[model samples]
Target: EEVKEKAQDVKKEAEVKAEEVKEEVKEKAQAVKEEVKEEVKEEKAEIENKIASTGNYPDLITSLKNNPWTSGDLNTRVKFEDIRRQVTLHEEEITDLPLDKIKTSLSPESLVDFLNMTSAKPTILNRKEDTSYEFTTRDPKEIDLIKKRYGLLDREIDKITSVLIFDKEGQKLKEVKDVLAEGKNRIYMETKF
Candidate 1:
């Protein structure tokens, strides 16, 4: 009878020890899982922060690519149309700004002194008998700078023989430039007729 009791007691102790080990393992697993989650959160945040620091067009594309909606997950919901609308609105706002403001904002280097250095005057002359108009500039460099700055490179000083000039009231003035290779006074245009 005493042997039986001893055997029962040893079995109970072993069972209790096994249960305790299982609990310990469960607790360790839970702890490891939490640590892994924390590490993942930290890494994700680090990557996002790194990307955010690059505030440029390429970074914007990267951010869109990194989104859950773009990761082949059809179930993820995103407001892409709203984002596109906002971008359009911002573009419209930029386009509505005055020319001076746009120039001040986009001028890479201040060429104010260079612009002031030119002593050029644009003149438009029209003769009743002539079929064409005449537009001329004393300093072609100034005209070049103005045209280049305003994205009007199509009209060039040397190449353009005759051009139509518009007044404030939108009247077409006949203009011509006299092509002078070497002279004290450079005449921009001249019409034979």
Candidate 2:
């Protein structure tokens, strides 16, 4: 009777241990599933941020192509409008510069003063209707500075334009991908039991 009780106790202990192990495994599996879900969510968020930053205009373009409509063509129209606005603003800013005031501020001995006093500024000298005067400075350092500034501005404009283009392209690609995915699903459904 003592041996039988000892065996029963051992069986009960083994069963309890098994239950504990099963519970631990379940908890671990749940933890792993949650971790995977969080990682997937983070990855998706990152991609969304990238797409948003680039303007995702391509999607609009793609939608337009897939289903053409006069009013629904937002991508091209918006791009054109943005370019026009930027050009206009640039022109206005350039015109607002006080060129005459700047020239008067310089001493008569300075090269700019000499040019101003003599009206040697190419734009002032070459007043031809068809020909436009291009400013060319002999000082390499000054020229380099000017070139750098010009390049910087050019790069900024290019960056903006690129983002717009990227958006349009991305949108189109997404639409195409969706269509392909649908077709693949249809094919899979037709083939599978």
Candidate 3:
């Protein structure tokens, strides 16, 4: 009878130990689950941030469109158009003017002064009596037009450069977000299994 009672006690002790082990395992599993959830939340937040940053691309495009140099200024645009017409007329006149007459008509001193004012580099032509200066003009009036156009072009280029930098940063963020998202998904799948 004593042996029987001792065997029963041993069985009860073993059962209690098994229950304790089960409770410990359950707590550990809960801890792991909470950790995974926190990680997933963090990953989602990071992805959301990446998406928001990329979403600013449209605003950048709008800012470029609304820039005063590009679209907002009307006077510069009209001036550029007028200069373009004048340049066309001048090009036609160039064909009629004899090369020597054209050379003689343009005063060397005035030409040099104009070059200095415009900060243009003068090409020196080899001549016997008088030094012939050739001013290679891509339509002086058209050049003025492009100068006006540059106000717009410069702003656009700057905006574009900014947007490109933003895009690169956004892309890197997106890649990181993707990796995090994938990791989260893997964790989710593992949890399910």
Global fold similarity of model 1 (TM-score): 0.31
Pairs clashing in candidate 3?
none
- Poorest stretch of ten by lDDT in candidate 1: 73-82
lDDT of 2 at 135: 34
lDDT of 3 by residue, 48-151 (tens): 33332223234433322222121222111011112323333232333322323222222212222333333334354334432323233334442342223223
Residue 74 lDDT in candidate 3: 18
RMSD of 1: 24.1
lDDT of 1 at 176: 19
Cα RMSD, model 2: 25.1
The estimated TM-scores of all candidates read 0.31, 0.32, 0.29
**Tens-digit per-residue lDDT, 87-155, candidate 2:** 322222344333233222211112122222222233312233222222333343433332232232221
Q: Which TM-score value belongs to model 3?
A: 0.29
- Sort every candidate by lDDT, greatest first: 1, 3, 2
The true-versus-predicted C-alpha distance at residue 173 of model 3, in Å, is 19
Residue 54 error for model 3, in Å? 5.6
Off by over 4 Å in 3: 53-193
